[model samples]
Target: MRMPLLCIVSAVLCLSAASGFAQGESPPAPAPSAAEAQSAKQPVFNQEQLDQMLAPIALYPDALLAQVLMAATYPGEVAEAVTWSKANPKAQGDDAVKQVAKQPWDPSVQALVAFPQVLVVLGQDPVWVQRLGDAFLAQPDDVMGAVQRLRQQAKAAGNLQSNQYQNVTVQAAPASTASSAPASTIIIQPADPQVVYVPTYNPTTSYGTWAYPASPPVYYPPSPLYYAGTALMAGLAFGTGVAIVNSLWGDCDWGRNDIDIDVNRYNNINVNNRIGNNQNTWQHNAVHRDGVPYRDNRSRQQYGRQLDGASQRAAFRGDDAQRAQARDRARASMDKAGIERPATSNRQARDQVREAQANRPRATDRQPQARSNRDNPQARQTLQNRPNNSAGRARDNAFEGVRSPARTTALADRGRTSQTLAQRPNASRAAGHAISRPSAPMRRGGGGGRR
Candidate 1:
């Protein structure tokens, strides 16, 4: 009885495989059979021993982990079922036994049990399901031959039989004839209703109709380069593997479009504040390629505007402590204006010009004074009253260099004469004539035009 209890408990270890297990849970070992007693030497497997055995293989790849777990769980359940069958030979397998029996060591069975109820769980999880099926079909139960047939069909003819598991049958009992009938005394009829009893045998298996397990691992021609080949194929099959992993680890991407939409909308509201659209470019190119996006632009814009309004209020609360905050607000406003500016706008450049104008000085900074002018009557009369001597004129010209008084007078006279000539229509011709006038037969005295 205790042995049976132990056996049943051992079957319970298979439950860990049913649900995705934590890293710490250990798989149970196959129960030892009586035949092993004759050997006098057999390995004893406790829970710890089972844990140790399963631990090394626990970190299988995501595509293969479900299969590994199923493989680990199947042996113990099969051994328990075998033990139960041996113990109660006459008794029919009950619901529990039948249920255990129904768990055909099939990969698809394991996958179905492992995943939560979802549509895509079936379609996209071929590799994982195949891994499970491979593990199940390879189990040491007596179904190997039948599974082999199925596998052969899957391989060559691309078809599997419907009755691979329906071979076991039970015969009906014959009618009892203990009491004999009297000969014509009562014109005896054949015993009215002879009842025959037939026993029904149901064998649990995964080989029946429509029980096609998941697709098997696809094989292709091997490339000469090892790592390159591995990386290329593995990357191509990565979606399948990743999906299986997500199912196992409970981390899948969903509602991706909503996230993308939200991000774009947020950027749109702050569009003026857009600093070169790096985020948008990243979202469009890398993020979209890698994952899904959120909802539309309107929500994001509204959210950003709300944040801006709240910050502005906090900035304007007139405490000296808020001065820095106010400066930040001003800076944010300018940034916003810049961001919102028209594509062809040059408002910022104009602001720079205004700043420069504000720093320039007015003309009132200089002192004022008068220059000697012949237009003054006194200066003109003085000029007219001067002796008309060539030597006097020469003296006047000499004084023009210094002394500040007569020098002003001579300079004034020269200025007046220059103005008079400048007013003439032929001023340039008159000046040329004056310069070219042959200086008193310059051959006698000096270099004239040369000076």
Candidate 2:
């Protein structure tokens, strides 16, 4: 029995030794308390969080932060980063900005996330954000998915997507970046966007060209002294033409005034004389230095054509048409000859001629008187008969001649005194008395002589 018991005891002790070796191979640590676990999970920070976290590692720089803020991908983060960078000026131009850009970001929730501000403030190097965006695009399943998950986690930790928080957040944030898509989103208040106005030059059709007032035409008179040469030529032509036509045709027979004086005589004399005078004048004018035809030549040719046409028309038609054509020919001829008649003067001359012609006795009345002279033989016999007494006729002529001057003088003296008396004041009373008292001396002489 003792030997069996010994074997069992020995087996038990071996088992115990093996169990002790297995249990004591590793020492057991004490379990953590709740307060200690909580303290370990949370991090402590002050207002200078960015500097305290990123400055020591040289992971962010002021310039890179400013550039990232300027990029404005996540306006809230960008604005925050700018404030942080401005406070920590020493955190500028650090080349380690690349490493910070590689960190993960959560746009949906406010939590620790990758921000490009430090990278921008450090160098304004586009390579930092580009590198980050490339990485995210390349491994979207990993980095982007992680960020989404972290966003949800942050939401659970009191970072809710609420309107109240978003309104305040957007108000605090800057304008978004010019990128195709914004990198971060926080619930933001709808603010009226700043209006950027661009000025443009617009042309109006209403205002066209500007115009100025025109000056009126000035008038000048021909001076007797200055235009002596022209005046002399004109006078000579006119006088010569008038004298030649009048002396050749007495009292204007055969239409001398109508056809010859107005047409052949005036034109031939005036134009020939004027051309002779002005032939050398055109030589000094630049307008005629090339030996062009004179201006007067063109004018005269035009007038001649008009006159010829009018004359042809008149010859084909009758008297009425002839008169009208003659008048028109005269006007056109005057224009060609550079003759200008004042409207008033021409009218007066025409009126005077019309009055004289109107006042003359009609041919119809004069014809009968002329016929009476031819027919009346008795009237001729009476006129021719009897004044044969020479002494008697001479005595009668002497008596008439003697009585004529005395009678004329007495009548003249009487008329002057009577006119003066009639014009005087109270002359009517004096006239009455003189009429009643009648020439006393003459009356007494007449009565005594008769007695």
RMSD in Å for all candidates: 34.2, 57.8
Candidate 1 on 1-451: residue-level lDDT in tens? 2567877887787675755456655657787777865443332222222222222222122222332333322333323333443444332212222233344333212222222111122233333333332232222221222222333322233221122111111122123311221111101111111110111111112112323223222222221221132222211111111112111211101111001122333233233323343432112111111121112232223222332377567547654566878767877887878853222247877776677687665455322212344557787788899787999888987776675786788788999998988988578685675434555655657666655
Q: Which ten residues in a row have the lowest lDDT in candidate 1?
A: 181-190
Give the per-residue lDDT of model 2 (tens digit) for 332-387.
99899998643547788888778879999999989998778667998667657857
Model 2 — TM-score against the truth?
A: 0.14
In model 2, the runs with Cα more than 4 Å from the true position are 1-131, 140-143, 163-451
TM-score for all predictions?
A: 0.14, 0.14
Please list the residue runs of candidate 1 whose C-alpha ends up more than 4 Å from where it truly belongs after superposition.
1-312, 319-451
TM-score of 1: 0.14
Name the lDDT value of residue 337 in candidate 2.
93
